[model samples]
Target: MKRVLITGGLGFVGSHLTDELMAKGCAVTIVDNLSSNVMTPADYPGCEVLVGSIEEVYPTLLETSKPFDEIFHLASVVGPAGVLQHAGVMAQSIVMSGEAVTRIALQHGSRLVLASTSEVYGRAGELRESDGCQVSSDVTVRLEYAVAKLTSEVAALNRAKVTELQVNVVRPFNIAGPRQLPDGGFVLPRFVVSALSGEPLTVFGDGSQVRAFTDVRDIVSGLQAVMSSGKNGLVLNLGNPANEITILDLAQRVRSLAASKSEITLVDPKALFGPLYDEGIERVPVVEQAFSELDWRPVVSVEQTILSTLDWYRRRLGLSQHESVGVAA
Candidate 1:
């Protein structure tokens, strides 16, 4: 059986990747600090989990957990809100996790797959894996997180070359799915929750900002595809290309899908993300490389992803909704 170690294995992308790996009969071990940003352990059972900061525990954990076939480094500071709220942790995690995982993978001869983000592209147009990450001098609140993730990617590549450890980088673009936190700033979840609750949707910047939303299922599948195909020392953009939707359009879809009569209100982007919001615009990925090299292309539609998320959130909320109705004679 193939053994894999996933850092931040309890997070949004990590949890989904864990499920996919388990489904493929891969033995998986998860290490997560579960900072206040997200919950711990999710609902998955029988997962080998180590609960501690990657900084404090990664060296020892890596030493003991050697001889792995592959390591998926998915831990990170995450979104703009995450960086802004936990700047210190973000910086530490970015540096510590990268060093620990890269060193361990090199020592154990484990093929490494690093999960990078399109946010590293910043305001760049039509992102490609060959296009090195864009750096901004602007005091964008999220700059620290982007810089850290980008640096980690470079570090992984350099380590790969020095140690002959096979490494692949996968930069995912705006993945959204069932487990997304409603209170989190992810636009889709926010809109879905607001629509479900009959509350007005908050559309930032006239809802014109465009973003690419891919399903977590597709992302996990893409990672498996890349690793299975024996592709190493390559960077792949794993994301859906056809589904670039505007915030207003996304809100409309949520309202229709949830069957809610909620109003869509426009909010200043500055109010949502502070004044630095206007610094740059993010664009979708060009996945031609993934197609030719790994035979991997996103199969899930944005609409399907949204509807699946809606169903999951609805059930999750229903369980916590009204009081139990059983035995009410």
Candidate 2:
């Protein structure tokens, strides 16, 4: 069986990816600190679990982690909110983790895929991998996360240029699906959770701010496509144009789907937790690169994503029956 190593195998994206990889008959090795209350591999039996930090114990763990054919580096210190809380660790983790993963993957002759964020785009408009936009200096707190990810991306690319260790980077837009933490500050899942619990759906900045959402399933498919395409040294964006929805619309939709009479409240943008949390909007991928190269496109609709997310939250809240509620505007 082909063996794959995932650095943050217990996270929302990482856990789902682990499930996908294992279902393909690939032996999976997971390295996670479980800082996020990661779902255990007991939940996914037949996978190797190494509970530790990649930055601290990766070298030793990688040495014994067996012959990995591919390495998926998904662990990072900063989510949007975590970045604001631990700027220093976020910067350190990105750089150190990338460098360590690159070295280990190269030694094992393993192909590496680094998980990156659209936050690297900053306030830049219509970002593409080929597009040259400097990381925004306006948001000093967010700058650390952006710069650290960019640094890691550059390091991986440089390593791929010289070594046989195939390295590719994926810039994932806002991904929302089941298993996301409600307190983690991801908007869609939060909305679903709030509506399920009859809590106010808080919209920041009049809810006009827009974001693109990619289903975790779609992201897993995109990752598989990149691995098959042998698209080393390439940076690709994985997202759906249809996933673009305004914050207000998202809250309304969640409430409708859950059939909850939750009130929508707009909060001050400044109250948002991320460091340098400014209210703004961003679009999805440019489609041209993803379609031509990965032969991949998101087939799921925003409505489906919303419904699935609501179902997940409802299940989490132990609600048995879902009511028929019209889609709210």
Candidate 3:
């Protein structure tokens, strides 16, 4: 059995990754701060979940001499609203987690896969893996989070160059699906919940912003593909452009799919993000490299992902499905 360590293994992405890895017969240990997730070992049967920041747990982890075959670093201060709370500390958290995981992976000869963000591209479209992460001198929370994630990537690559540590960086664009909460200012979940509750789906900035929402299920599958493929020192953009849609269209789709009489209201984004928004123009990913290297491509459609998320919310909220959507968009 393959043994792996996942930092933030209980977060939205990390939790899905854990389910897949464990199903494939990999022994997975998780280190999550539980800032977003609230669960104990009873919630995740058969998985050892360590609840704390990586920095706080590093010393005890090293003392125990736990050897892992792979390390997946997915921990960070996420979402637009989430980063607003950590203006000065987001960059610090990114670097600290990067250093701890990089060192541990090096010590045990474990392959490393670091989760990054497409926010690093900064207002660019058709983002390729080779593009330099755009840096802004102004005070932008989104840019701060992006630069911090980029810093972590740089540090990991520097370490890989020296010790031959197999490092692959995954820059995911607009991810959504099960277990995602709207508290973090993620647009899709917020819209879905509002539509389901017979409330208006708020569209920030005329809902013109174009984003390609990749299902978390497909994203985790892409992560597994990166680990399975014998590649080293490569950066891959893992998202589906085929699922691209505008925010207004997304809201319309949600209202239509849920068969809700909810209205799609246009609201100023500043009202939502509270000076925490960056006007990024049409952020999409270039996934040719991921497909060529890992033989991976997202198979889930935007409509399918939306219905799947709606179904999850329905079950979680104790509401039955719409009774009309039978795997049909």
lDDT of 3 by residue, 131-203 (tens): 7666878778777788888888888888888887889899999899978888778888888888778778898
Candidate 3's C-alpha lDDT? 0.84
Deviation (Å) of 211 in candidate 3: 0.4
For candidate 3, the per-residue lDDT at 292 reads 84
lDDT of all the models against the reference? 0.76, 0.78, 0.84
- Write candidate 1's Cα lDDT for 212-259 as tens digits: 888988898888787777877788888887988877898988787676
The TM-score values for the models, in the order shown, are: 0.90, 0.93, 0.95
Between candidates 1 and 2, the lDDT winner: 2
Give the Cα-based TM-score of candidate 3 against the true structure. Answer: 0.95
Q: Which pairs of residues have clashing backbones in candidate 3? A: none
| Segments of candidate 1 deviating more than 4 angstroms | 36-39, 272-280, 319-329
Deviation from truth (RMSD, Å), model 1: 4.0
How badly does each model clash, as a count of residue pairs? Answer: 0, 0, 0
- Candidate 3: lDDT of 118? 89
Deviation from native of the Cα of residue 55 in model 2, angstroms: 1.5
